[model samples]
Target: MCSASEGQSRRSPISTFSPGALRRVLRTADGVLVEAVYEPCTAGFEGNSPAAGGTAIVVAHGFTGSVDRPAVRRAARVFAQRAAVVTFSFRGHGRSGGRSTVGDREVLDLAAAVEWARSLGHPGVATVGFSMGGSVALRHAALHRGRTEARTDAVASVSAPARWYYRGTAPMRRLHWVVTRPTGRFVGRYGFRTRIHDRDWDPVPLSPVESVPLIAPTPLLVVHGDRDPYFPLDHPRMLAAAGAAELWLEPGMGHAENAADEPLLARLADWLVDAAARPRPAAPDAPRTA
Candidate 1:
């Protein structure tokens, strides 16, 4: 069920190319207003194929990214060819209200998006998240596992970190500086247009690897690039091992939405469509490392 503050505006379409696109302001569980756009499916695998017939995919952007970013829009366009797409701005980014908790409270933002997709009459809903968004997706699926209204039928995490507070790579070190320092926050605000919260996580929420074990039977996919500068190959491997998820280690891809090509996006759409149609298995007693 959508919150009372969640409302739709059909007056402004995303673009002329998308005739039935609707823009909305969704109120998250924590009362943050998130900006979202829904693009109806344009084409399908076959006429009224399952891939295009009943599924809606929610696309979560990386840190410093929003619904209007070129990479986000391009991804939505590609996925819309197979399924209706919902793209949203995380809190503290783009036009959304509130400050970013990075990956902590962002799960609430994703839950709201998933609920909004359900309210739109999509019987099957999947989530595809990149970078920080990927971490949020995994946690959202785990935290809201029992809530039918907020749970995802399928989930794909692209270029996500398996554990938190990692500073193994240069880009991650630079990111930490931008996230933890006053001067860095200023640059993130003015340069990236991202408003990060100053406070640290009091009690850190579940990490991606820990959360993965709780998402079994939901059809999880862990995708990462060998050449990703943000997170190394171990990140995806750890996630896949924990959840028994299907892993795809792309050879030349880089990181996040910027690195996902159209072919890969199309393949993901097909995977989500097929996965959502399958029956969910029983949860395992322990994490699957093999």
Candidate 2:
């Protein structure tokens, strides 16, 4: 998601051969149907070790992005080198059935993807999300609190805003208009091929910064670009500081998934692979009562 460089380039490696992809209509915990593609690992499932064996990766795309997008497929190809890969279009994006709730209800969509990864016999799962999807990954992992099958052992978020309602950049400003104004929504549907619902968040969902604290003990990697127009360095800094997580700030990167190059993704895959070798984290401490 580099600024002008990314926006100007319209090239992606074409997928020549299919990789055992199976299409599925996954119903989220809240009853939304998510269109997903699951590609079994080429190396076979290596059980629950993050190091030597095989794990699974669930790829979450950014706003206006889908599983079929060349970017998403390229990412899947990278992660599939070491594990099973499940890529899905968030509700309201592609063939998924529902209007986008932006990031609020989207956590359910991510949870469903994570659960699906575990159900496929992979003992370890990592959720890699970009931009809006990145925010959802953080919140969804926090919500699990390492308590259920939906728990994602590790998470990597790229170019995600630490908090919401930011309009510091031109792209973000335009994005706000698209999400908040009827005229912009109409444009989003027709111009961007996205279908977002018309509903204000009744009660604001947990912000990404707040979710970071709750995600600790589960390994987290926060990746952002200093050149990214949407969010400044403060965003990833806050996330890393709160979660005690690792952060990688590339020098000239742009937005979310598109910001990540193949080498960067390979490094992330290495991190996830290393996480798989480590033992599962202990259950999160019980919440103390006042």
Candidate 3:
């Protein structure tokens, strides 16, 4: 946990730039320091690309994943072909501070990243997340709906669960153990370099299904694989049904970042760009005068 002085000092976002990447240690609302990287669009202004030069795509990685992970970097590179991209390590993962509340408090981390993206002057911002990050994306969009600086223009959740505490699958059961048991946490710290929180959620955060409905007016896409070992097809279906989101049930893909291929990543980038360009629904008319 950050001391009062340290937290106050980091209340504002701070950033630095390398040749092609902007690196930052963003402070979440809860005082956790999250590590993030921003890569400018590489394919600058191709013919008729809706997002041409004014959009930012925030990439949220899965559990045990970080900004430096190969999978996250690959996705960021692909997304940068269309829009400026920001990738961040959720708290407790990589160099970030604070313990993981799993998906509960992670929304604060995503919110800080989105605010940083907007601060960079991008007119539009979108979020694309996988697994644990996917859940954060949905919840953040819903929770921050009225907060202009923190809300996302569009959101895509890949391989996310509809509800929490799901232990139907073997992989999920193992993940629960990793989050619940002290020995499992030890393995996570030593083996995966991920630090798990010791306590359970005080009040369980809103589940993805519940959040989906609140994300309306902001486009939503839910992608899942038929062969996913962690979450079944029913997960995406539930999300799609709840929010009328675009759903893609992949054929042979398995799980999060590892299962996402280049082609799929490209498609997600295109969808985000197009979705950001889409006009929001018009407001209902006032009562007509006689």
Candidate 4:
């Protein structure tokens, strides 16, 4: 299994960020600890709150990424310019402990991270997730729609896969479908020695397309690279179609390109700030199941 550092040294097109940000280790009830970073903004943009600024954004890393991964770190800084930023590694990634559950348990880890951010006293909280982390963020929004403590004010998902089985015949999509599950099994068993979710629990079921609707009156921004291979451009559009969210098909953008594209970062920051400024929608009551 290749680590993010290995991918970086090889100069892959995936996004990369600078280092030396604030670090925190949060212990979970399961006794697993994860590494999270609080990235401070440079001296240019406004709003400086310890935790939740007037606007706060939590950036989540992709599969096999740590808090130090280039994309996550860069986004943290980007958002920090306008809002307080926090980035964290999922269990079994980076310096965090415990096994990987593909996307199943990672959602819970994300919820915990959000709680941590709220405890810091920020008024508005937005979650920005990439790839697999994108799916996790959408799921959290769906599951905790109206809860006051864990409410998600806004969301942005980049290169979020809407389905586990990529429908595209493109080589990358085909390759991902052919390899993702088997690789997940092999890596969890040997490389990371982690537990796999039960076969009955399909991670795709927790995808953004299904969860984005749950965000409801809470604003959402969905961006995908037009040229992305793993997930087709239509995915985010379909998500927007299912609900009232805004979709951006970044022209000529490819998977995870938001890290390197200054324009995209600017757009993201703009969305965050606008969402923060807009009158917040009253969280609808949580729906109780029969």
lDDT (Cα, tens digit) per residue for candidate 2, span 1-290: 11222322233333521456667899987789998877766555444432323588888888888777777777888887877788888888877989888888888888888788777777888888899999988888788855677888888988999998988888888888888899978977776667888888878888999989888788889999888888999999999999679999998988888778898888888787677557755767432110
Candidate 1 residue 44 Cα shift, in angstroms, is: 7.1
By lDDT, highest first, what's the ranking?
Answer: 1, 3, 2, 4
lDDT of each: 0.82, 0.78, 0.81, 0.65
lDDT of 1 by residue, 119-233 (tens): 8888889999999999999988787766458888899999999999999987888888889999988987887778899999988888999999888778899999898988888
lDDT of 1: 0.82
Instruction: Give the residue spans of candidate 3 off by over 4 A.
Output: 1-19, 45-53, 281-290
Query: Which segments of model 2 are wrong by more than 4 Å?
Result: 1-17, 43-53, 285-290
TM-scores, all models, native as reference: 0.89, 0.89, 0.88, 0.80
Model 3: per-residue lDDT, tens digit, 1-290? 10111111112223222236767899988788999987778774433223324889999888888787667777887888888889898998878999888899999999999999988888789999899999999998888766457878899999999999999987788888888999988977776777889998878888989989888888999999898888888899999999859999999988887688999999999999889778896322212110
- Top-scoring candidate (lDDT): 1
**What stretches of model 4 exceed 4 Å from their correct place?**
1-21, 28-31, 44-52, 167-205, 257-260, 285-290
lDDT: the better of candidates 2 and 3 = 3
lDDT at 173, model 4 = 44
Tell me the deviation in Å of residue 222 in model 4: 0.6
lDDT score, candidate 2, position 178:
88
